[model samples]
Target: MEAKEKVYLAGGMESDWHEKLKQRFHNKFLFYNPKDHQLDASEQYTLWDLHHIKKSDIVFAYLEKDNPSGYGLTLEVGYAKALNKTIILVDEKSDTNNEFKARFAIVKNSASAVFDNLEEGIKFLERFSIYVG
Candidate 1:
């Protein structure tokens, strides 16, 4: 049997987007969800996120205007980049110049590629055989 890729979903859990991604990619990837764990503070969440990122084959990050200023997600992107992990960034927000500038740094330096939507990102991963039958 082929083993599913380990995809670390890095983004804001405050919205339902994380759950949507989980449901969409359930069969193709084994996800390490921070929402599933009990994380109380930055320190705890940081440790948990880093641990999983280290084990993951890819880091799929979703960033939006409403969920902007994601310190944890930013940190995860940097860490994943440093570790040479494949990073697929889904930027669903950034309508203003400031937002675009803020996201530009991470997108340029950390992301392997960027997408306007989650479906596009998923399609990009298909080349790696990450889509389910």
Candidate 2:
């Protein structure tokens, strides 16, 4: 049997979006949610994130424009880029009519693919990987 591809869901844990995404992609890939772990310490969380980002095949980053200051997410994206992991960056605050506003520059540039929202990102993922179907 082939090994399942791993995708690390990164970004704000303010909502249940990560959990929902995991459920959505459960059958397609092995989804790792850092939020599920009991990472009470910032150091522990950072270490855990770094380890998984290195192991994952793809890093799916969801960054809302309103919540743009993700120190951890920024670092993870940079590391993933250096390690040659596929990065799917979703800019949740992007307006379809005005693309210039609310874009996360570093993450957007480092990403292998960028999307406006989670829904659009998921659609892109489906087409980009045969395993997603």
Candidates in order, TM-scores: namely: 0.85, 0.84
lDDT of 1 at 100: 62
Q: Which stretches of candidate 1 lie over 4 Å from their true place?
A: 99-103, 130-133
Clashes of each: 0, 0
lDDT of 2 by residue, 1-133 (tens): 4566788988887888887776776677888789888788988988988999999998998876666466667788899999999999887654532444444475678999988888988887665457444
**Alpha-carbon RMSD of each model:** 2.2, 3.1
Question: Under the 3 Å rule for N, CA and C atoms, how many clashes does model 1 have?
Answer: 0
For model 1, where is the 10-residue window of minimal lDDT?
Answer: 94-103
Cα lDDT of model 1 overall?
0.79
